[model samples]
Target: MTISSRVRLICLTGALALSVTSLPLSWPNPALALSDIKDITPAPPEQDPPATPAPAPAPGDDEDLSDEAFPVIPDPDPLIKPSNTDESDATTPQEPAPEVIYDLEKAPEPVRRMRQLIMDAAASGDIQALKPLLDVGANQTQVPLQTSDQDPIAALKGLSGDDEGQEILAILLDILSTGFVQLDKGTPDEAYVWPYFAGKSLALLSPRERVELLRIVTAGDVAEMQEQGNYNFFRVGISPDGRWKFFAVGD
Candidate 1:
């Protein structure tokens, strides 16, 4: 009689209708009255599906992901090593300094002297002698006795008179010919009289004969002769026969 009782009654009626609708035609054999169940047959069972192949494993799957995956390799000891790279030898190897060889036969007088001076300086440990000779090829302005229009080498040819003088002359010849002036000029304090001449007379000598003539003059002892006239500051004299002959000192 109330709203709750009415709702319950409607639900009961809907359930009864659904049950009746879903009922089979017969109680036990629903298709018993059908002509043939075989004629209305079900489809045959599907053959078992072909087996699918498993996918191949990715590379390095067996490798460990842990910190210990790859072993650390220590560097090989240098002492015991042979290498895939270039292996350096342990022996102390030396490279020789460049050497200059002199040909005594073909050597010009100047070259011979240059060699001799180098040898003598090296022997006596008087290396200062080497400087002047080395300067033999430089300009004449450096020579103390340099004259206007006079060739430096020729001037040296005119001066060298002894063993020391010859050495100086040789240096002069070498420098004049080679024009290679890469060394120092020795000081007068070193008593570099001959070597100094060689250094000073570089680039002045023009001929082999001039060198020979200079060698003769340089072989003498040099001294100031005299002040001949107003313009004549006399040094060592040249004779009419082209010899280096000292004259009166002050007359």
Candidate 2:
């Protein structure tokens, strides 16, 4: 035979031997036979396109990534409103400027004249200007409080005759300037307080004991003023005719 025919004959013999070797030699369980077993790894199912992430750019393609390939940032949400987080900021409602029930221009003639006298006496420490107002027509009896060393609330004029009388005058002026808020007569607090120094209106009281509050507050006004550093508000007590009974620093 020729070389080509000999080569083909040898290949055919090898394939027949391999096929015979692969065949089962003995009988086995029919349920566990090779034909009965299914493949554990089925041909890989086709992958879905949506599950894949977008490919990142190559290093050479990263030209000034900050400016060109800018990171996507979410914009502010439209549903929610921005809030003012600062506690000290002025955006919060400021205390409504205290309503001035009495100002220099709006005050009655008697009150205006009295204020002028007090101002002059306080400025010059001269009781002479205060003498006319201190007289009985004014219903002001210039009685000495005889309580404190300064006796600020002692009399209408305080100690205007003395050098430090300016202090007392200022206190009285602050009291007069305080706004008036009418007290409810039906209230039990107002009823119990009616017997003392008869006044129709209430002056905000900072003291605990309302019994001698009238006298104590008069003396305490000076201390309270010194402590506060400013006369922003005053608890004012006035009679039906508008005569001030006693005034003290209050809300």
lDDT of 2 by residue, 1-251 (tens): 99999999999999999999999998684667788788888688887677678688787785545744787687978886656657435466644323324344544454445545555655665444444444343443324445534333344344444554555555455444333333433442221111122232124434532333344245475456446543323343433333433333333
Q: Model 2: which residue pairs collide?
A: none
Query: Candidate 2: minimum summed lDDT over ten consecutive residues — where?
Result: 189-198
Global Cα lDDT for candidate 2: 0.45
lDDT of 2 at 60: 78
- Put down candidate 1 lDDT per residue, 147-221, tens digits, no spaces: 665654454435555434464534433323321211122432211112222222323434653453344344232
lDDT of 2 at 57: 79
| Cα lDDT for residue 71, candidate 1 | 67
TM-score of 2: 0.27
